[model samples]
Target: MRYTLRQIEYFIATAETGSITLASERVNISQPSISTAIAHLEQELDTQLFVRRHAQGLTLTPAGKALLVEAKRLVEHAQQLYEVASEANDKIRGQLTLGCMVTLAPMIMPELSHAFTSAFPSTKVMQVVGDHDTLLQKLASAEIDVAITYDLHVPEGFDFVPLASLPPHVLVGEIHPFARLSAVTVKDIASEPLLLLDLPISREYFLAIFMQEGLTPHIAARSPHQDILRTMVANGYGYTLANVRPRSDTAMDGRKVVRVRLAGDHRPMVIGLVSPKERRKSRLIELFENHCRNRISDAYIPGMVAPVMEKRIRLD
Candidate 1:
Protein backbone atom coordinates (compact mmCIF):
# COMPACT_ATOMS: atom_id res chain seq x y z
CA MET A 1 0.00 0.00 0.00
CA ARG A 2 1.22 3.53 -0.84
CA TYR A 3 0.41 6.89 0.87
CA THR A 4 0.58 10.19 -0.95
CA LEU A 5 1.74 13.66 0.26
CA ARG A 6 -1.76 15.06 -0.35
CA GLN A 7 -3.13 12.32 1.98
CA ILE A 8 -0.58 13.34 4.64
CA GLU A 9 -1.51 17.00 4.32
CA TYR A 10 -5.22 16.16 4.68
CA PHE A 11 -4.42 14.02 7.75
CA ILE A 12 -2.47 16.86 9.41
CA ALA A 13 -5.17 19.41 8.59
CA THR A 14 -7.93 17.24 10.01
CA ALA A 15 -5.85 16.49 13.12
CA GLU A 16 -5.22 20.19 13.72
CA THR A 17 -8.79 21.46 13.13
CA GLY A 18 -10.62 18.47 14.69
CA SER A 19 -13.58 18.96 12.27
CA ILE A 20 -13.90 17.54 8.79
CA THR A 21 -15.85 20.64 7.64
CA LEU A 22 -13.13 23.01 8.96
CA ALA A 23 -10.27 20.83 7.61
CA SER A 24 -11.94 20.78 4.19
CA GLU A 25 -12.22 24.57 4.26
CA ARG A 26 -8.57 24.93 5.32
CA VAL A 27 -7.32 22.57 2.60
CA ASN A 28 -9.76 24.11 0.06
CA ILE A 29 -11.42 20.75 -0.70
CA SER A 30 -14.99 19.42 -0.18
CA GLN A 31 -15.87 17.90 3.21
CA PRO A 32 -16.58 14.45 1.72
CA SER A 33 -13.21 14.49 -0.06
CA ILE A 34 -11.46 15.12 3.27
CA SER A 35 -13.37 12.28 4.93
CA THR A 36 -12.63 9.92 2.04
CA ALA A 37 -8.91 10.72 2.13
CA ILE A 38 -8.74 10.13 5.90
CA ALA A 39 -10.69 6.84 5.53
CA HIS A 40 -8.38 5.67 2.77
CA LEU A 41 -5.28 6.51 4.89
CA GLU A 42 -6.67 4.54 7.88
CA GLN A 43 -7.54 1.58 5.67
CA GLU A 44 -4.04 1.55 4.14
CA LEU A 45 -2.48 1.49 7.63
CA ASP A 46 -5.03 -1.06 8.95
CA THR A 47 -5.93 1.04 12.01
CA GLN A 48 -8.77 3.18 13.28
CA LEU A 49 -7.63 6.82 13.19
CA PHE A 50 -10.57 8.84 14.51
CA VAL A 51 -13.50 8.46 16.94
CA ARG A 52 -16.53 10.44 15.65
CA ARG A 53 -19.93 11.20 17.16
CA HIS A 54 -22.93 13.43 16.27
CA ALA A 55 -21.99 17.19 16.48
CA GLN A 56 -18.98 16.26 18.72
CA GLY A 57 -16.38 16.78 15.95
CA LEU A 58 -13.54 14.13 16.07
CA THR A 59 -10.97 12.73 18.51
CA LEU A 60 -7.78 10.76 17.68
CA THR A 61 -7.44 7.10 18.56
CA PRO A 62 -4.14 5.79 20.00
CA ALA A 63 -3.15 4.80 16.46
CA GLY A 64 -4.22 8.18 15.18
CA LYS A 65 -1.87 9.96 17.65
CA ALA A 66 1.15 7.98 16.41
CA LEU A 67 0.33 8.54 12.75
CA LEU A 68 -0.25 12.24 13.39
CA VAL A 69 3.36 12.64 14.57
CA GLU A 70 4.79 11.13 11.39
CA ALA A 71 2.23 13.01 9.27
CA LYS A 72 3.33 16.37 10.73
CA ARG A 73 6.99 15.56 10.10
CA LEU A 74 6.35 14.65 6.50
CA VAL A 75 4.41 17.84 5.91
CA GLU A 76 7.17 19.91 7.53
CA HIS A 77 9.88 18.29 5.40
CA ALA A 78 7.87 18.92 2.27
CA GLN A 79 7.41 22.58 3.20
CA GLN A 80 11.11 22.89 3.90
CA LEU A 81 11.95 21.45 0.51
CA TYR A 82 9.72 24.02 -1.17
CA GLU A 83 11.25 26.84 0.94
CA VAL A 84 14.78 25.79 0.04
CA ALA A 85 13.90 25.60 -3.63
CA SER A 86 12.29 29.03 -3.56
CA GLU A 87 15.24 30.54 -1.69
CA ALA A 88 17.67 29.07 -4.20
CA ASN A 89 15.74 30.84 -6.93
CA ASP A 90 15.78 34.13 -5.01
CA LYS A 91 18.56 36.12 -3.26
CA ILE A 92 20.79 34.94 -0.42
CA ARG A 93 18.77 34.52 2.77
CA GLY A 94 19.85 31.26 4.33
CA GLN A 95 22.60 30.55 6.87
CA LEU A 96 26.23 31.18 5.93
CA THR A 97 29.09 29.45 7.75
CA LEU A 98 32.51 31.12 7.99
CA GLY A 99 35.81 30.23 9.62
CA CYS A 100 38.89 32.20 10.64
CA MET A 101 42.26 31.70 12.26
CA VAL A 102 42.57 32.38 15.99
CA THR A 103 44.70 35.53 15.70
CA LEU A 104 42.64 37.16 12.94
CA ALA A 105 39.39 36.43 14.82
CA PRO A 106 40.07 39.14 17.39
CA MET A 107 41.45 41.84 15.14
CA ILE A 108 39.06 41.79 12.15
CA MET A 109 35.86 40.06 13.28
CA PRO A 110 34.21 43.08 14.90
CA GLU A 111 34.23 45.12 11.72
CA LEU A 112 33.12 42.22 9.58
CA SER A 113 30.27 41.36 11.95
CA HIS A 114 28.91 44.91 12.02
CA ALA A 115 29.15 45.43 8.28
CA PHE A 116 27.69 42.06 7.26
CA THR A 117 24.81 42.26 9.70
CA SER A 118 23.90 45.77 8.63
CA ALA A 119 24.00 44.96 4.95
CA PHE A 120 22.22 41.60 4.98
CA PRO A 121 19.78 41.65 7.85
CA SER A 122 17.98 38.46 6.87
CA THR A 123 21.05 36.30 6.47
CA LYS A 124 22.32 34.33 9.46
CA VAL A 125 26.08 34.28 9.94
CA MET A 126 27.84 31.53 11.87
CA GLN A 127 31.56 31.65 12.60
CA VAL A 128 34.05 28.98 13.64
CA VAL A 129 37.50 29.72 14.97
CA GLY A 130 40.47 27.43 14.57
CA ASP A 131 44.11 27.33 13.63
CA HIS A 132 45.14 27.66 9.99
CA ASP A 133 45.34 23.94 9.21
CA THR A 134 42.03 23.12 10.87
CA LEU A 135 40.20 25.93 9.08
CA LEU A 136 41.71 24.87 5.77
CA GLN A 137 40.30 21.37 6.20
CA LYS A 138 36.85 22.73 7.00
CA LEU A 139 36.85 25.04 3.95
CA ALA A 140 37.88 22.18 1.66
CA SER A 141 35.12 19.94 2.99
CA ALA A 142 32.47 22.64 2.42
CA GLU A 143 31.92 22.87 6.16
CA ILE A 144 32.78 26.58 6.07
CA ASP A 145 31.96 29.11 3.38
CA VAL A 146 35.21 31.05 3.65
CA ALA A 147 38.23 31.53 5.91
CA ILE A 148 40.24 34.58 6.91
CA THR A 149 43.81 33.84 7.89
CA TYR A 150 47.48 34.65 7.49
CA ASP A 151 48.91 33.93 4.04
CA LEU A 152 50.86 30.84 4.89
CA HIS A 153 51.64 27.88 2.65
CA VAL A 154 48.01 27.59 1.43
CA PRO A 155 46.89 24.29 -0.07
CA GLU A 156 46.53 23.97 -3.86
CA GLY A 157 42.75 23.95 -4.17
CA PHE A 158 42.34 27.31 -2.45
CA ASP A 159 42.50 30.80 -3.96
CA PHE A 160 43.83 33.69 -1.84
CA VAL A 161 43.05 37.41 -2.03
CA PRO A 162 45.60 39.63 -0.35
CA LEU A 163 43.87 41.82 2.24
CA ALA A 164 46.45 43.37 4.54
CA SER A 165 49.92 43.06 5.99
CA LEU A 166 50.57 43.23 9.74
CA PRO A 167 54.21 44.04 10.36
CA PRO A 168 56.06 42.29 13.18
CA HIS A 169 56.52 44.22 16.43
CA VAL A 170 58.17 43.53 19.76
CA LEU A 171 55.95 43.36 22.86
CA VAL A 172 57.89 44.01 26.05
CA GLY A 173 56.87 44.11 29.68
CA GLU A 174 56.26 47.70 30.76
CA ILE A 175 58.73 47.30 33.60
CA HIS A 176 61.38 45.76 31.38
CA PRO A 177 64.40 47.98 30.71
CA PHE A 178 63.79 48.18 26.97
CA ALA A 179 60.17 49.30 27.47
CA ARG A 180 61.42 52.84 28.11
CA LEU A 181 63.02 52.92 24.68
CA SER A 182 60.98 53.98 21.63
CA ALA A 183 62.47 51.17 19.59
CA VAL A 184 65.13 48.51 19.96
CA THR A 185 67.52 46.75 17.59
CA VAL A 186 67.93 43.03 16.95
CA LYS A 187 70.95 43.00 19.25
CA ASP A 188 68.83 44.10 22.22
CA ILE A 189 66.09 41.42 21.71
CA ALA A 190 68.63 38.68 20.86
CA SER A 191 70.24 39.05 24.27
CA GLU A 192 66.98 39.03 26.28
CA PRO A 193 64.78 36.08 27.22
CA LEU A 194 62.08 35.56 24.55
CA LEU A 195 58.52 34.32 25.03
CA LEU A 196 57.48 32.65 21.77
CA LEU A 197 53.94 32.55 20.33
CA ASP A 198 54.49 28.78 19.71
CA LEU A 199 52.08 28.52 16.73
CA PRO A 200 53.84 26.40 14.11
CA ILE A 201 53.78 28.98 11.30
CA SER A 202 54.40 31.99 13.55
CA ARG A 203 57.25 30.23 15.32
CA GLU A 204 58.90 29.46 12.02
CA TYR A 205 58.54 33.06 10.89
CA PHE A 206 60.11 34.47 14.07
CA LEU A 207 62.98 31.94 14.06
CA ALA A 208 63.70 32.85 10.47
CA ILE A 209 64.03 36.51 11.46
CA PHE A 210 66.69 35.69 14.06
CA MET A 211 68.52 33.36 11.71
CA GLN A 212 68.72 36.12 9.13
CA GLU A 213 70.32 38.38 11.75
CA GLY A 214 73.02 35.81 12.60
CA LEU A 215 71.82 35.40 16.23
CA THR A 216 69.69 33.13 18.36
CA PRO A 217 67.06 34.29 20.86
CA HIS A 218 67.26 33.10 24.46
CA ILE A 219 63.98 31.16 24.74
CA ALA A 220 62.08 31.37 28.03
CA ALA A 221 58.45 30.25 27.52
CA ARG A 222 56.17 29.19 24.65
CA SER A 223 52.40 29.74 24.41
CA PRO A 224 49.58 29.33 21.88
CA HIS A 225 47.29 31.96 23.45
CA GLN A 226 48.44 35.47 22.70
CA ASP A 227 46.73 36.81 25.84
CA ILE A 228 48.74 34.42 28.00
CA LEU A 229 51.97 35.61 26.41
CA ARG A 230 50.78 39.21 26.84
CA THR A 231 49.98 38.68 30.52
CA MET A 232 53.34 37.03 31.09
CA VAL A 233 55.05 39.97 29.41
CA ALA A 234 52.96 42.39 31.52
CA ASN A 235 54.51 40.83 34.62
CA GLY A 236 57.98 41.21 33.11
CA TYR A 237 58.27 37.47 32.46
CA GLY A 238 59.70 38.03 28.96
CA TYR A 239 59.07 39.75 25.64
CA THR A 240 57.47 38.32 22.50
CA LEU A 241 57.53 39.12 18.76
CA ALA A 242 54.15 39.28 16.98
CA ASN A 243 52.87 40.39 13.59
CA VAL A 244 49.21 41.17 14.34
CA ARG A 245 48.64 43.92 16.88
CA PRO A 246 45.88 43.63 19.45
CA ARG A 247 42.73 45.53 18.41
CA SER A 248 41.70 46.27 21.98
CA ASP A 249 43.02 49.40 23.69
CA THR A 250 43.95 47.92 27.10
CA ALA A 251 47.43 47.02 25.81
CA MET A 252 47.54 44.17 28.33
CA ASP A 253 46.83 46.55 31.23
CA GLY A 254 47.64 50.18 30.28
CA ARG A 255 50.92 49.58 32.10
CA LYS A 256 53.54 46.83 32.40
CA VAL A 257 53.42 46.09 28.63
CA VAL A 258 54.21 48.03 25.47
CA ARG A 259 54.81 47.44 21.77
CA VAL A 260 57.98 48.77 20.18
CA ARG A 261 59.31 48.61 16.62
CA LEU A 262 61.80 45.82 15.97
CA ALA A 263 64.94 46.63 13.99
CA GLY A 264 66.37 44.66 11.06
CA ASP A 265 64.38 43.56 8.03
CA HIS A 266 62.11 40.89 9.53
CA ARG A 267 59.61 39.62 7.00
CA PRO A 268 56.14 41.07 7.60
CA MET A 269 53.16 38.72 8.01
CA VAL A 270 50.76 38.63 5.07
CA ILE A 271 47.14 38.47 6.20
CA GLY A 272 44.46 37.71 3.56
CA LEU A 273 41.04 36.27 2.73
CA VAL A 274 40.94 32.55 1.81
CA SER A 275 38.27 30.39 0.18
CA PRO A 276 38.02 27.08 -1.67
CA LYS A 277 39.06 27.37 -5.32
CA GLU A 278 36.26 25.26 -6.78
CA ARG A 279 33.32 26.53 -4.78
CA ARG A 280 31.13 29.07 -6.55
CA LYS A 281 31.51 32.58 -5.14
CA SER A 282 28.78 33.46 -2.67
CA ARG A 283 27.43 37.02 -2.62
CA LEU A 284 27.51 37.16 1.17
CA ILE A 285 31.11 35.96 1.23
CA GLU A 286 32.05 38.41 -1.48
CA LEU A 287 30.49 41.31 0.46
CA PHE A 288 32.35 40.41 3.65
CA GLU A 289 35.64 39.98 1.78
CA ASN A 290 35.23 43.33 0.11
CA HIS A 291 34.61 44.98 3.47
CA CYS A 292 37.81 43.44 4.84
CA ARG A 293 39.83 44.58 1.85
CA ASN A 294 38.45 48.12 2.13
CA ARG A 295 39.07 48.33 5.88
CA ILE A 296 42.62 47.04 5.47
CA SER A 297 43.34 49.41 2.63
CA ASP A 298 42.01 52.41 4.52
CA ALA A 299 44.23 51.48 7.46
CA TYR A 300 47.29 50.89 5.32
CA ILE A 301 50.43 52.91 6.08
CA PRO A 302 53.52 53.24 3.95
CA GLY A 303 56.25 50.72 4.94
CA MET A 304 53.68 48.94 7.15
CA VAL A 305 52.00 46.91 4.39
CA ALA A 306 53.78 43.55 4.21
CA PRO A 307 54.45 42.34 0.70
CA VAL A 308 52.86 39.01 -0.25
CA MET A 309 55.98 37.69 -1.93
CA GLU A 310 57.25 35.94 1.23
CA LYS A 311 57.78 32.19 0.79
CA ARG A 312 56.28 29.62 3.21
CA ILE A 313 56.23 25.84 3.60
CA ARG A 314 53.12 23.71 4.17
CA LEU A 315 53.41 22.12 7.60
CA ASP A 316 50.42 19.81 7.34
Candidate 2:
Protein backbone atom coordinates (compact mmCIF):
# COMPACT_ATOMS: atom_id res chain seq x y z
CA MET A 1 0.00 0.00 0.00
CA ARG A 2 1.21 3.56 -0.72
CA TYR A 3 0.04 4.76 2.73
CA THR A 4 -0.86 3.25 6.09
CA LEU A 5 -3.61 4.04 8.59
CA ARG A 6 -0.86 5.14 10.97
CA GLN A 7 0.05 7.89 8.53
CA ILE A 8 -3.57 8.93 8.33
CA GLU A 9 -3.77 8.97 12.13
CA TYR A 10 -0.69 11.14 12.31
CA PHE A 11 -2.10 13.43 9.65
CA ILE A 12 -5.39 13.76 11.54
CA ALA A 13 -3.64 14.43 14.83
CA THR A 14 -1.53 17.16 13.31
CA ALA A 15 -4.49 18.72 11.56
CA GLU A 16 -6.55 18.70 14.75
CA THR A 17 -3.90 20.04 17.13
CA GLY A 18 -2.49 22.38 14.45
CA SER A 19 1.09 21.57 15.56
CA ILE A 20 3.38 18.62 15.23
CA THR A 21 4.65 19.00 18.82
CA LEU A 22 1.13 18.93 20.21
CA ALA A 23 0.14 16.08 17.93
CA SER A 24 3.12 14.08 19.18
CA GLU A 25 2.10 14.82 22.76
CA ARG A 26 -1.50 13.92 22.02
CA VAL A 27 -0.72 10.58 20.38
CA ASN A 28 2.34 9.76 22.55
CA ILE A 29 4.62 9.63 19.51
CA SER A 30 7.91 11.33 18.80
CA GLN A 31 7.90 14.68 16.96
CA PRO A 32 10.07 13.40 14.12
CA SER A 33 7.87 10.34 13.72
CA ILE A 34 4.77 12.53 13.29
CA SER A 35 6.58 14.73 10.79
CA THR A 36 7.85 11.71 8.85
CA ALA A 37 4.37 10.18 8.67
CA ILE A 38 2.90 13.47 7.44
CA ALA A 39 5.59 13.76 4.78
CA HIS A 40 4.91 10.20 3.61
CA LEU A 41 1.20 10.92 3.49
CA GLU A 42 1.68 14.12 1.48
CA GLN A 43 3.94 12.30 -0.97
CA GLU A 44 1.44 9.46 -1.41
CA LEU A 45 -1.41 11.90 -1.99
CA ASP A 46 0.74 14.07 -4.26
CA THR A 47 -0.42 17.26 -2.55
CA GLN A 48 0.50 19.50 0.34
CA LEU A 49 -1.97 18.92 3.19
CA PHE A 50 -0.79 21.71 5.42
CA VAL A 51 1.20 24.91 5.35
CA ARG A 52 3.75 25.01 8.16
CA ARG A 53 4.51 28.31 9.85
CA HIS A 54 7.80 29.00 11.65
CA ALA A 55 6.53 28.96 15.27
CA GLN A 56 2.85 29.38 14.58
CA GLY A 57 2.02 25.70 14.01
CA LEU A 58 0.40 24.28 10.85
CA THR A 59 -2.74 25.28 8.98
CA LEU A 60 -4.70 22.92 6.75
CA THR A 61 -4.59 23.51 3.04
CA PRO A 62 -7.75 23.07 0.97
CA ALA A 63 -6.71 19.49 0.29
CA GLY A 64 -6.26 18.85 3.99
CA LYS A 65 -9.70 20.24 4.81
CA ALA A 66 -11.29 17.99 2.19
CA LEU A 67 -9.55 14.88 3.49
CA LEU A 68 -9.98 15.45 7.22
CA VAL A 69 -13.70 14.58 7.31
CA GLU A 70 -13.32 11.40 5.26
CA ALA A 71 -10.21 10.41 7.22
CA LYS A 72 -11.99 10.69 10.58
CA ARG A 73 -14.90 8.62 9.29
CA LEU A 74 -12.59 5.97 7.88
CA VAL A 75 -10.57 5.72 11.11
CA GLU A 76 -13.68 5.46 13.23
CA HIS A 77 -15.22 2.87 10.94
CA ALA A 78 -12.06 0.84 11.06
CA GLN A 79 -12.16 0.93 14.84
CA GLN A 80 -15.79 -0.16 14.78
CA LEU A 81 -14.97 -3.07 12.52
CA TYR A 82 -12.37 -4.31 14.97
CA GLU A 83 -14.73 -3.97 17.90
CA VAL A 84 -17.48 -5.87 16.11
CA ALA A 85 -15.17 -8.71 15.04
CA SER A 86 -13.77 -9.09 18.54
CA GLU A 87 -17.11 -9.01 20.34
CA ALA A 88 -18.28 -12.28 21.91
CA ASN A 89 -21.80 -11.07 22.71
CA ASP A 90 -24.61 -8.97 21.20
CA LYS A 91 -23.76 -5.92 23.23
CA ILE A 92 -23.34 -2.75 21.23
CA ARG A 93 -19.66 -1.88 20.81
CA GLY A 94 -18.45 0.53 18.16
CA GLN A 95 -17.83 4.14 17.25
CA LEU A 96 -21.02 6.14 16.64
CA THR A 97 -20.82 9.59 15.11
CA LEU A 98 -23.70 11.91 16.02
CA GLY A 99 -24.49 15.41 14.84
CA CYS A 100 -26.86 17.88 16.47
CA MET A 101 -28.20 21.33 15.78
CA VAL A 102 -26.27 23.97 17.67
CA THR A 103 -29.28 25.22 19.60
CA LEU A 104 -30.43 21.72 20.54
CA ALA A 105 -27.02 20.42 21.63
CA PRO A 106 -26.86 22.27 24.92
CA MET A 107 -30.47 21.47 25.74
CA ILE A 108 -30.54 17.74 24.94
CA MET A 109 -27.14 16.26 24.03
CA PRO A 110 -25.80 15.74 27.55
CA GLU A 111 -28.68 13.61 28.74
CA LEU A 112 -29.04 11.73 25.43
CA SER A 113 -25.28 11.03 25.32
CA HIS A 114 -25.14 9.86 28.90
CA ALA A 115 -28.09 7.50 28.51
CA PHE A 116 -26.86 5.99 25.25
CA THR A 117 -23.24 5.51 26.38
CA SER A 118 -24.32 4.08 29.74
CA ALA A 119 -26.57 1.58 28.02
CA PHE A 120 -23.69 0.49 25.82
CA PRO A 121 -20.51 0.91 27.84
CA SER A 122 -18.36 -0.62 25.12
CA THR A 123 -19.41 2.01 22.58
CA LYS A 124 -17.76 5.36 21.90
CA VAL A 125 -19.86 8.38 20.88
CA MET A 126 -18.44 11.20 18.80
CA GLN A 127 -20.58 14.33 18.93
CA VAL A 128 -20.61 17.12 16.36
CA VAL A 129 -22.60 20.34 16.64
CA GLY A 130 -23.60 22.86 13.99
CA ASP A 131 -26.56 24.66 12.49
CA HIS A 132 -29.40 22.82 10.75
CA ASP A 133 -27.94 22.99 7.26
CA THR A 134 -24.50 21.93 8.42
CA LEU A 135 -25.81 18.93 10.37
CA LEU A 136 -28.08 17.88 7.52
CA GLN A 137 -25.20 18.22 5.10
CA LYS A 138 -23.01 16.02 7.25
CA LEU A 139 -25.73 13.37 7.46
CA ALA A 140 -26.17 13.44 3.68
CA SER A 141 -22.41 13.16 3.17
CA ALA A 142 -22.15 10.10 5.48
CA GLU A 143 -19.96 12.08 7.85
CA ILE A 144 -22.30 11.34 10.76
CA ASP A 145 -24.43 8.31 11.59
CA VAL A 146 -27.45 10.30 12.73
CA ALA A 147 -28.46 13.87 13.47
CA ILE A 148 -30.78 15.57 15.96
CA THR A 149 -32.44 18.71 14.70
CA TYR A 150 -35.71 20.39 13.85
CA ASP A 151 -37.67 19.08 10.87
CA LEU A 152 -36.82 22.15 8.85
CA HIS A 153 -35.82 22.07 5.19
CA VAL A 154 -35.00 18.35 5.38
CA PRO A 155 -34.22 17.09 1.92
CA GLU A 156 -36.32 14.35 0.29
CA GLY A 157 -33.76 11.58 0.72
CA PHE A 158 -33.70 11.47 4.52
CA ASP A 159 -35.65 9.63 7.21
CA PHE A 160 -36.98 11.58 10.17
CA VAL A 161 -38.35 10.32 13.49
CA PRO A 162 -40.10 12.85 15.61
CA LEU A 163 -39.07 12.81 19.27
CA ALA A 164 -40.56 16.03 20.57
CA SER A 165 -42.28 19.20 19.43
CA LEU A 166 -41.19 22.65 20.58
CA PRO A 167 -43.63 25.48 20.04
CA PRO A 168 -42.57 29.01 19.30
CA HIS A 169 -42.61 31.44 22.20
CA VAL A 170 -41.58 35.02 22.72
CA LEU A 171 -38.44 35.66 24.76
CA VAL A 172 -38.10 38.88 26.69
CA GLY A 173 -35.84 40.44 29.31
CA GLU A 174 -37.14 40.53 32.87
CA ILE A 175 -37.54 44.29 32.66
CA HIS A 176 -39.16 44.29 29.21
CA PRO A 177 -42.79 45.40 29.03
CA PHE A 178 -43.90 42.02 27.71
CA ALA A 179 -42.06 39.97 30.34
CA ARG A 180 -45.00 39.76 32.72
CA LEU A 181 -47.51 38.81 30.04
CA SER A 182 -48.71 35.21 30.05
CA ALA A 183 -48.85 35.20 26.29
CA VAL A 184 -48.72 37.44 23.23
CA THR A 185 -49.86 37.09 19.63
CA VAL A 186 -47.70 37.19 16.50
CA LYS A 187 -49.07 40.62 15.79
CA ASP A 188 -47.79 41.77 19.19
CA ILE A 189 -44.39 40.25 18.46
CA ALA A 190 -44.31 41.90 15.02
CA SER A 191 -45.03 45.30 16.49
CA GLU A 192 -41.87 45.19 18.61
CA PRO A 193 -38.23 45.11 17.55
CA LEU A 194 -37.06 41.55 16.92
CA LEU A 195 -33.75 39.91 17.77
CA LEU A 196 -33.43 37.19 15.17
CA LEU A 197 -31.59 33.92 15.82
CA ASP A 198 -30.18 34.04 12.25
CA LEU A 199 -29.39 30.35 11.77
CA PRO A 200 -29.99 28.38 8.58
CA ILE A 201 -33.40 26.73 8.79
CA SER A 202 -34.06 28.11 12.25
CA ARG A 203 -34.02 31.68 10.97
CA GLU A 204 -36.72 30.90 8.46
CA TYR A 205 -38.80 29.05 11.05
CA PHE A 206 -38.73 32.07 13.35
CA LEU A 207 -39.61 34.48 10.63
CA ALA A 208 -42.34 32.16 9.43
CA ILE A 209 -44.21 32.87 12.65
CA PHE A 210 -44.62 36.48 11.59
CA MET A 211 -45.27 35.44 8.03
CA GLN A 212 -48.15 33.23 9.12
CA GLU A 213 -49.72 36.22 10.78
CA GLY A 214 -49.21 38.38 7.69
CA LEU A 215 -46.72 40.62 9.47
CA THR A 216 -43.05 41.44 9.26
CA PRO A 217 -40.42 41.73 11.98
CA HIS A 218 -38.47 44.85 12.70
CA ILE A 219 -35.11 43.17 13.20
CA ALA A 220 -33.02 45.12 15.67
CA ALA A 221 -30.14 42.70 16.27
CA ARG A 222 -29.07 39.29 15.01
CA SER A 223 -26.73 36.50 16.11
CA PRO A 224 -26.08 32.88 15.24
CA HIS A 225 -25.50 31.69 18.80
CA GLN A 226 -28.63 31.11 20.90
CA ASP A 227 -26.94 32.12 24.13
CA ILE A 228 -25.85 35.40 22.64
CA LEU A 229 -29.39 36.00 21.42
CA ARG A 230 -30.77 35.16 24.85
CA THR A 231 -28.23 37.41 26.46
CA MET A 232 -29.24 40.15 24.11
CA VAL A 233 -32.88 39.65 24.99
CA ALA A 234 -32.05 39.55 28.67
CA ASN A 235 -30.27 42.86 28.40
CA GLY A 236 -33.40 44.34 26.77
CA TYR A 237 -32.01 44.85 23.27
CA GLY A 238 -35.20 43.34 21.83
CA TYR A 239 -37.47 40.36 22.08
CA THR A 240 -36.71 37.09 20.27
CA LEU A 241 -38.56 33.82 19.62
CA ALA A 242 -37.54 30.24 20.35
CA ASN A 243 -38.79 26.66 20.58
CA VAL A 244 -36.57 24.80 23.05
CA ARG A 245 -36.75 26.08 26.61
CA PRO A 246 -33.91 25.87 29.03
CA ARG A 247 -34.87 24.94 32.59
CA SER A 248 -33.33 28.10 33.84
CA ASP A 249 -34.82 31.53 33.19
CA THR A 250 -31.41 33.19 33.09
CA ALA A 251 -29.04 33.66 30.19
CA MET A 252 -25.35 32.64 30.08
CA ASP A 253 -24.60 36.12 31.39
CA GLY A 254 -26.86 35.48 34.44
CA ARG A 255 -29.49 37.85 33.18
CA LYS A 256 -33.13 36.81 33.45
CA VAL A 257 -35.37 36.15 30.44
CA VAL A 258 -39.01 35.15 30.16
CA ARG A 259 -40.76 32.82 27.69
CA VAL A 260 -44.21 34.01 26.79
CA ARG A 261 -46.34 31.75 24.69
CA LEU A 262 -47.74 32.98 21.40
CA ALA A 263 -51.45 33.66 21.96
CA GLY A 264 -52.65 32.56 18.52
CA ASP A 265 -52.43 29.20 16.80
CA HIS A 266 -48.70 29.21 16.18
CA ARG A 267 -47.34 26.05 14.61
CA PRO A 268 -44.47 24.46 16.55
CA MET A 269 -41.28 23.08 15.10
CA VAL A 270 -40.62 19.33 15.30
CA ILE A 271 -37.46 18.12 17.03
CA GLY A 272 -36.36 14.74 15.75
CA LEU A 273 -33.65 12.37 14.48
CA VAL A 274 -32.51 12.51 10.86
CA SER A 275 -30.56 10.04 8.76
CA PRO A 276 -30.12 9.24 5.09
CA LYS A 277 -33.03 7.17 3.82
CA GLU A 278 -31.16 4.66 1.66
CA ARG A 279 -28.09 4.12 3.85
CA ARG A 280 -27.53 0.86 5.67
CA LYS A 281 -27.99 1.16 9.41
CA SER A 282 -25.58 -0.40 11.87
CA ARG A 283 -26.84 -2.22 14.96
CA LEU A 284 -25.36 0.56 17.02
CA ILE A 285 -27.30 3.12 15.01
CA GLU A 286 -30.53 1.20 15.44
CA LEU A 287 -29.94 0.81 19.15
CA PHE A 288 -29.17 4.49 19.57
CA GLU A 289 -32.22 5.42 17.55
CA ASN A 290 -34.44 3.35 19.77
CA HIS A 291 -32.67 4.71 22.81
CA CYS A 292 -33.34 8.26 21.72
CA ARG A 293 -37.01 7.50 21.10
CA ASN A 294 -37.35 5.85 24.50
CA ARG A 295 -35.34 8.36 26.51
CA ILE A 296 -36.23 11.77 25.05
CA SER A 297 -39.38 12.19 27.10
CA ASP A 298 -40.24 15.44 28.81
CA ALA A 299 -38.69 14.18 32.02
CA TYR A 300 -35.37 13.35 30.38
CA ILE A 301 -34.44 16.53 28.50
CA PRO A 302 -32.15 18.79 30.49
CA GLY A 303 -32.72 22.53 30.61
CA MET A 304 -36.34 21.97 29.68
CA VAL A 305 -39.18 22.71 32.06
CA ALA A 306 -42.05 22.61 29.57
CA PRO A 307 -44.10 19.50 28.99
CA VAL A 308 -42.73 17.56 26.05
CA MET A 309 -45.39 17.22 23.40
CA GLU A 310 -45.65 14.42 20.89
CA LYS A 311 -46.42 15.48 17.33
CA ARG A 312 -45.71 12.65 14.95
CA ILE A 313 -44.77 13.17 11.29
CA ARG A 314 -44.56 10.31 8.81
CA LEU A 315 -41.38 10.79 6.80
CA ASP A 316 -42.11 7.83 4.55
Best by TM-score: 2
Model 2 C-alpha lDDT per residue in residues 1-316, reported as the tens digit of each score:
7888888888887997799997898667999999999999888889999998987889999999999988988797787685577455666687788998898898788888887888778887878888988888878767689998888778899998988777788899999989888778887778788999999878888888878778889999899989999999999899999888787899989999988878778677887899999988877888899988887754445557545321211111
Local distance difference test values of all predictions, in order: 0.74, 0.83
Candidate 2 lDDT score relative to the true structure: 0.83
Q: Which regions in candidate 1 have their CA more than 4 angstroms from the true location?
A: 1-91, 247-255, 298-316
Q: Every model's Cα RMSD, please? A: 14.8, 5.7
* Clash-forming residue pairs, model 2: 247-303
Residue 3 Cα positional deviation in candidate 1, in Å, after optimal superposition = 17
What TM-score should be assigned to candidate 2? Answer: 0.81
RMSD of 1: 14.8
Minimum summed lDDT over a 10-residue window in model 1 is located at 307-316
Clashes of each: 1, 1
